[model samples]
Target: MRLRNYLLTSIILLTSLPVLAQYGSQKKADNLFNKFSFVSAAQVYHNLIEKDFNADYATRQLADSYAFMRNPDSAVVYYKKVVEQPNVPIAYYYNYAQALRGVKAYKESRVWLKRYKKAGGEINDEKFLKDSDFINSIFNAKQQYFLTDVNFNSKYSDFGAYEHDGHIYFASSRNTGVSTKHIYGWNEEPFLDIYVTDKSVNDSIIDHKSKLKGDINTIYHEGPITITKDGKTIFFSRNNFSKNVLGKDEEGMTNLKIYKASLIEDEWTNIEELPFNSNDFSNGHPALNNDGTKLYFASNMPDGFGGTDIYYVDINNDGSFGKPQNLGNVVNTDKNERFPFINNEGVLFFSSDGHPGLGLLDIFGTVSDKDNNIISVLNLGVPVNSSKDDFSFFMNEDGLSGYFASNRNGGIGSDDIYAYDRIPQLKIEGTITDITTNTPVPNAMVTLLDSNNKEIARLETDDDGNYEINIDRDTDYIINIKKDNYIEDTRQVSSKGLENKVRSITADFNLNRIVKKVTPITELYPIYFDFNKFDIRRDGTVELDRIVNLMMNTYPSMIIKIESHTDSRGSSKYNDKLSLDRANATYKYLVDKGVDPNRITEYKGYGEQKLTNDCDDTMDCTEEQHQANRRTQFIVIKME
Candidate 1:
């Protein structure tokens, strides 16, 4: 009895050990995750899953952790399991959908997106669901930027490139001269610091880099800055560290804040934190308008639409700031929106994962009115974006060249700076020709119209029937060709895929010539006859109707004669009778179709005498040649 009791007690304790361990592990993982230590939390959750202890919860947490770390490829593996379980959270459906997109699984991502919507989850962008072709349009849009990595990138996180005073200012985690470095837990890299490098005349290269001269360099994170036009002041993002104390919110987390410094003589001094910053949330990635009248940055203070939202404040002439205002729902989504850049033309460029993109975060541009209301957002397609996080976009006043950063593959660092130049031009060129003789239809009026049928330009073809016109990229165009004695031709052409590398597109036009005077009906379609047959074929009647309509409607006073010929396969006497019967058959067809009998001036048969080729019974020829000889013609006799 004692031995049995001992074994039962041992079994109970052993069975309870795993549950206790799982409970403790779950608490630890949750704490790390809430602290924004996603990398550490993911490892703990992954271990719990491998042991099959609280497997469902562990899987969900693991998926969330990877998602927060922007490791979608790994997150998708765990999310696939979490979403399949019963009673899954509605938010997980959205997370899975976004994860699927990060791996370029767009079709599957849309499926979950619809499920998320059906589950009462609100999607801010209704157009994303209503426009079924939206995703396809993003993928099919023309490539506007050509990107190349800068030569000065390091093996650490190097990004946030900006230009001012002949120097390129940026943020990097490549800490130098620090005896001991404090590493950020999120990416396991050194904390970010502000750095500057001399800009080479050739934009592709850069001179040696050094830390910005100032007391601005702190032990905490700093950088991704914006400077005033006169170079008298600067605004940069840093951790909530001031004086000698590091500030933390009630949650024991350090948040980002914007700080301003003045350039005095040769050193930057008088550092002061922006007034609207909070210890409870993050506000960073600063940008300024062309005249330095507005300051824009991303923040998640409170009541934001997503993890982070873009906000801007007015800069008074006395160096004071107004209240921060959200950029509105049109530009903000249920995901992180960061790195706001305003060009000289008032176009805003930023990065977002919420919008439909190839994968991860994609850079998008929007034009705003004077009141700062966005009209529409456009994805900066192709080499400018990739299946990874892309942010910190900067455009020069010229708007033709710029710089951006991405953590995509084949880079020298966790993130790398890239230079981009817009494609110069796109053109459409083509030739116009007549259908009858395949001759050039020169001097033809060629009109170009936009997709809405609005005329854009009109010109005439050159002496060679060729015309060339410049066109905008990624647009649909209609080419209308018209010439005297030729039927009008319209063609729909798209310049979508041609923007990648091809500079020009060829769109030739062919116009059919209308019958005006004496001409053989065979010029349009040969009125063919079967061997030894006199009845009009179904095809032959179609050609006969054209003659009937021309005489009755188009040219009421026109007259024509029906003449038929036969091949050399039969005797001359037999061929003559067959040809005559065919001529009479055509004559009767026109009269039955309401053509005046007076219009048919004559009906005759030429028999084998008018053999078109050398197949006069003695010379063997192909069937096509023999068939050509057995044809009928409706020659115009007179026209008034």
Candidate 2:
């Protein structure tokens, strides 16, 4: 549904006009305001209480235009000047509230929100309710206890504070060097280092500091620290200043590298460099998956969205690192992004100066699935962010209390840490089972969905076929259950205002046997393979395992011939050998995994001789259609 303008249609524009006796116009300021054209057509309302001051309708208009341009900070400053007028419109406060929200002044935003409501300014209540920033402010104020002053000093730039298990880990630039005084060009503050602080101390009156493990602290740049959910592994940034890795530059410092420190017994030891560190580029600000199978970090490597990008390095079977793959443009930009944190819910939190923010670098978060598909990147507005470089974020399962670093004064140093509590909006859960037999379908995938039918989570049924999904407590969600030999099932449920409780929702599906009339590959299609190679991916082998299980259940005594073929793109002789290798690879995988080799008796490679279509060998065919010729089939030669 199209949103109708809730307020008066006559949107006033701001511009400056010449008054009596002042022959010269304020050309520079007027021109500056005009250049920042707004997307929506704005009126030229004149705010003319000025002789030489750069004030007018356009100045006011420019502030509103800045909001449209997503430069909320500029808008806030201009709106502040406009609201000072004795007789300004109530709408000015309303627009100003939004600008305050953009810069992450939640309390100020709330004050304006109240003013907007008091003045009877029009707004979409539904939209306001759905605004994560507005909702989070209310949540933090009610559920969390914000930490007051952390007694440190004007000696560091601390931020990106987060909580793991029970401890708080943050980034700071506290004197750890013979002459530890480095400055960030952007904020002109001291360069950062990682720090840990505790939450058990009195926060409102005074802030206590946490100690670092020995001299684990480095003199070079360090930030974006994270601890595993189990509280065993600690990951943090280290500027790669290794003498061998980066040949001593004029500054004699290497690039940056993310290091992992593990806790063995009660002591943290065995500090080692992460897998993807190199001498060429800087790689830091790592975010680890819950299972520790994937590591996400930011880098300025080639083929990135812009400057620094978030990259994923998959963990190999032997715990070694794989090639780092860029997370693509979804989570990255040409702008500098730092301090990435991943919650147990798979939501990602980071700080960026590129995306429009209320200040220099504000904290932002995006809800993502296990596959890293981003649903939205929302600003953590108000109390959490401000008109300064507010970053180094952390959160708990409850989404209430967490810590972050900032330079908003009232701290021990150039930057200090703060903590706040918040309320978790809502969540969902359910189970999937067999309808006819009332038995659990182990390993079945149960997905929770939103209004757009986007899958939020793909939970697997436990050994007994019981599945539980945790989501925000008050949102609506759809459930989809998919299992082999069972009909696909879908259901929708709303958890609006539902308290934190395990909702018992039973989604039972009937098992449907494989009927010949149905599409055979409905269970299998679009098979995967390596680049220019016929070997199946590990996941493809898993898929084939299901096929093997199905064949064994349906025809226990059946003798089948496994045939593999390849597209006619290459020479027939080469195609023949490739096809045979693929068939042998599949056979070996099945055999090694305990599938009876005798039941998969014959293995044949047709060598592009068998075409599902009528295309001739030399005919020009699309690669997709050619793929049809390169296929795998199991023919039941004999069944008992």
Candidate 3:
């Protein structure tokens, strides 16, 4: 039995004789909901609440029905009550959060999102919360596209605009005025069908529109197609209907599939489902690469990272296929990601509710490397997206113009197709070099900040010391450059008044290298003692005072070791004792001059050894040469 029937039977068996009427009403409403007639089910559920009969269950079901109908305003009202009920399902918290976002209650949505996480909801809530500022950055981004609604929109749903061979093909639910027209129960709208029209001469007003010529437009839902460069083959999404029968899964729910059709004699014929279609899960919204060697689509197959993830299959030269590969976590999230469109430049554009956005679904563009690895995902920002479902993006080879769909306010229908022209990107490019050497400073950190000092982009310079970045027109930015052992540099730049004319700006930086000696010794006269004496002499005191000034004031954290030596004229045993006393005497002098005892790491004596010159007993050297051997040396061990 279906969940509705089982639930109804349970309610009937559990209820007493006094509440049969209430249970009877619930059974009727549950039947409508089970049949996918959400509009009718919502009305019945509302009636149950008005009569105060099992209002809690009625309210929860009512909210779900409205959500199925895509009416968040109505859903939020009942969902609020459902969530406040004791022991409500944890999923309801997530549902409530999404509903709040639909109404532009972002702050309230985040609050519920936190509650959902606290309730053990299994989403990457921590990352989502930490990226809240990133969402705000997208909202505050400059407008990139100029959008206007197309004139072909209808009072019902109309979206998914694709242009091929100077004509526009789209999906619509506009009534065909047929007496036997089928109605979709979920939204109470007519079944979607593929429609085509000539490209508007004025780019917005369509002279005429008609159903696509072919068997491709089924009585069931169909549309959102992609055509090859040769224009001979077309791939489109359709209900899982074949051989005059609608296919369903084990749970009695229909799923969508991608179908291929050939253009023969001005008619689309030989329609066939792709080999990957299944009754268990949906695979729809086909997109093609520029060369048509790869086909991309959205699916909800098992082990997917989200409700729906974008997958692509390689179309081999012999007309065979490769296994589908998921686009991975960088693009897919725990929410729906759909409508994959790859532009001529190989950039992927799709709509997602998963990524942080203004609200609902928003269009985003991908930046990939030469190996096709995604490096970054960029939100298209306002005018192309709003706090509503925006998707079905299609861009021309030039990339400066495109079309998209949205259900945002002021649309002529539930979803309307909008044409847009992208503004040319403004950029800043430059190199960083060392000031003294005039050489490139590779791998230097380059940061771009807005007028308010908020970071917009941060990257490292390439091997050539070159850095390039895109910026908004008519905005002020701060460029900061930094590298190790070099002084950081900052420069202010402005794109104001440049508008769409000037495309690039140059900003270079020259950093000064920090110069410091690494050796332990400081430049000073040698500290020499009298013959066989460890006491401080007048000449030795001069050098000792300089060492005290350096250790006590210049570098307080500096640690040094004292090494004392003696001339070869003294006995080895006698010289060792004299050198030891001299080393100790120097250590005591520095300590008495207010230097920390711990700063002197060691005091060592090397007698009649490590002579600077050949002044041993076998050679008769001058008195000055012997004095050099009696000197003390200070070796710095540590310095901060």
Cα lDDT tens digits, model 3, 227-253, are 999999999999999878999999999
lDDT of 2 by residue, 144-215 (tens): 223544553335566666666555566665554435466657677656655564556443221223435643
Clashing pairs in 1: none
Superposition TM-score, candidate 3 onto the true structure: 0.47
Candidate 1, residues 467-544, lDDT tens digits: the string is 766554556668788888778888887765543435467788877656565534333345999888888888888877
Instruction: Name the top lDDT candidate.
Output: 3
Query: Candidates' lDDT values, in order?
Result: 0.75, 0.59, 0.76
Displacement of the residue 321 alpha carbon in candidate 2, Å:
1.8
Off by over 4 Å in 3: 1-140, 177-179, 201-209, 425-640
Report the Cα lDDT for candidate 3.
0.76
Clashes of each: 0, 43, 0
lDDT-based ranking: 3, 1, 2
Candidate 2: minimum summed lDDT over ten consecutive residues — where?
1-10
